[model samples]
Target: MYQLSEVESNYRRLFKDFLRNSYISGLKPLLLHSPVQYAKALWLAFLAVIVVWTHIVVVNLTLEYIDQPTEIHMAPNLVHVSNSPFPAVSVCRSNMINRGLMNNYAFKIYQHQTQYEGTFANDSRYPPLDLERLTDRLMLLTNFFLNTDGKHLDIDELGQLHNLLTSYYNGSVYSVHDILRELTPDCGDLVVRGIIYGMPVNTSQLFLKRATSSGTCCIFNYRRPSYSQSPGQRELDDAEMAALPQVVFESNSILNGIQFVLQDTHQDDYTLSFLTNTAFRLQIFPQEDYATVQSNKHGEILVDHNTIVEVPIQPKFFDSSAAVRGVTPKVRRCYFPEEGRKLLNQSYYSLDECILLCRINSMLQHCGCASSPMAGTALNVSYCTLLDLPCLMKWRGIWNGFNEYPYVEQYEEGAEDASSMSQCPLCLPNCDGVNFEITSNVAPLRKAFNATGYAHGLLKSLNNDRPLSIIKLFFKLRFAQSTQMAMVGDWVVLLNRFGGILSLMYGFSIISYIEIFYYLTGKWFVLYYRECHKQKNDSNKTELDSSSLHWNE
Candidate 1:
């Protein structure tokens, strides 16, 4: 704004000069020239005021006609950090339900989450975690984490949210796994596997990751370009989002949310006939090195070790795996090649054989494999030459990934059971030969299955470990030859579903029928002998008579 004195000085000088000049220049037109200009200016000001008022009123009326909702974008904030290098770490925020009955601690939980921006983005972890187990541990140790994260989640804040989550998810008698029931259902045959695949926030190829011995840890510090759900739906009407229960995970953040498997192995390949086709929300292997890629031109089956699976990304806040212990080898003793179970089976490796071998491998991995203490020292305890020695056991009733959980094996009404479920019995209270399950995609899977045998109560124990596998239609199949075949059973179930054949009983195939009939009747040749009655007296008499006749002749 111009100072009053400066404006007044210019107006007075210019106004006085203009008035004097006009008054003298045009005698007739100079009448009241200064006052006339002032009157005109006042009229123009009134018109300008009216126009400005009209513009304000129109804008106000237009705003009243349109109701625009506030816009808010929710890009899941997944985080990961680990103290141990090999075992990655993750944390994330999740939704919690009222537990049917509300608790006083509810606000405490919410308050803890608040105090941030309007969007108090809870951390969702990408590292793997068993919801039940992690929650259980958290229930036991809550205060520790709350105190720890109090330090803050940033460099300025020295605490972490890891401890905070574990304590919040302990299972109570009323404790329900809202996440499990929603994610892993009894009737549903599915597994959700996710991986923290990295991508850039911009159009760069560099995957967002932290530096490590194995190149970079694909932690949440980097944006997951394609892993998150598609953006901009205008409304949050997704059932999964609406029904998301309180996660019993130990995290405030999560990693990439991409998945792998959607179907089992055989559905897409002939080599995997025994395997029913199914898909997992997150299909992952025990080892990350073999992260499954669409091995074919089209991204489909994940295959390795002559085994195939539906690939899935590592999900948020999930950690650990089918733990395989390290081995402490002994004399790594000298044993005959035939001593191996492969030779003992002679027919093919049974499910029991597979477990023993796999268990051995797992144990070896845990026992300081590179330099085992047992090597060249304790021969008997460290290395057993015979796998089938009297004491050497064939563990049965062990679980497999084949069957869903909570299904306990029951007795088949009329069928005579084997002497024992497995060749080698297991300890009581533990699943031995009687309770066996195939949980992974292993080679020669059919070689280990019974053509016509299944565990009745298998799910009873499986519920303690894995979810179901088969889809609904697999069991609903009716073969044209079902009448001839007689009894049809759920051979191999996937994600707790029955569809494909994991095994077949003595199916009346041409070869099998021939093999059975050969032994029933003497179809080939059978040698028989009958003792001839000794006719000693008749022989002697006949001889003598012949001699006499010869002499007479």
Candidate 2:
């Protein structure tokens, strides 16, 4: 590849040099020379033309294999009709193609990113790509298709990438934007436009603000029709819990335009209606998203939808948060897909939110790992599945008989004026007078999970059992979780922590000691590359000099 480029550069350089010198160097004598000489020169020129054509053909073919869009196995195009049941219809989607190519082609973003680095292939250790991975798209053709390769690709370059795609989708076809949002009980309508590799993603867009006038009655719209609770249409056993709705509403914030959708196994057929009737609108499409999502937790391409709504409020470019012209980001899982002319409402998950949930669960997990919750001490652990850890485990006692480990319980604080422990379903009597009352605010959350039947009521009963400091800390956490205000503050703090960790990781990666070893070993490879370039240039120069000398003779 390098040789071919170098040769092309050398040939172009020689041509330019000859043109510049000819006008000033008395080249009029050549045309006046004998016809025999001109005939021989024409024959030589014809051979050179053939050689250049061969070189161009070879280089083009090589790049085709290295970097290009694979032909897309296009799905039948969906068209909207005026008579459809769901009204206020606006249709938009994107596809890429070319003249000669018979079918629609898409760029396999995974394969593309992996191709640059030798990361993926049919290797023994890794599993195969499942159905979830296939439909999830990473490469989005944006209004301004940003090329991360640090090179500008006009029409010519895109053609080389894939002749098929280039022929079609040559310019902007759909004025659409994407946004990514999380698949929550409340999240329904959203879309994703930007790319997150190795993860199944979907998107939606909606306005976000602190809920309500007194900051209490926050409005939300899950971008879908409200789920009218009827047994015939679908079953609402666990997910559509009426008892624990307060927990879902606790951290309430107003998102202007999101429609709710439910996803199991990364499949979206269900959605919650957070729109018109803000209160009891827990919707579901098919509940297929859970099964689909859980099936490939290692990673999967989540196939979800992004709602495209042309808002009349304001429009702006996507550079920074300030430049973003919308309600201050609600900081949910979803993201906005595009930033150009045709605005898009996208749906996606926010990494920060996931990390927050992970951090919260991390504490629970660590706590679980620490104590033997068997005889009078630890709770019994249940293995739900491969990915799921048990709720609690029991403490193994000194005697042969294993004592009863209480369910996971909360402990009230010992500090002065500590908030009262809120009660949950699992009310185990404390042997040490360790009273753990569940707070009223979070009590609804506990109820919601229970309504779903999977909740093993907060196995809390730790009241006054341990140290004062630990008790204070646990109470403080409960307080923060109870009050939505503190929860938001915690999220911001987590963001800062995450940013710091990322900076440290990046700072160390380039200068790490192992890199030093590779630097030493690979320095020779770079040196050899330079030498090769130098030799090729010299050879081209020598050939040009020889041709000049022969012409003079």
TM-score of each: 0.16, 0.16
Residue-wise lDDT of candidate 2 within 223-337, one digit each (tens)? Answer: 2211212222122322332222121211111122122222111222222221222122111111111111111111211111221111111111111222222322322111233
- In model 2, which runs have C-alpha deviations exceeding 4 angstroms? 1-35, 73-553
lDDT of 1 by residue, 248-347 (tens): 2222122222212112222222111112332222221111111111111012222332122322222222111111011111111111223333333433
Error of 1 at 71 (Å): 55
The Cα local distance difference test for each model comes to: 0.24, 0.24
Q: Give the TM-score of candidate 1.
A: 0.16
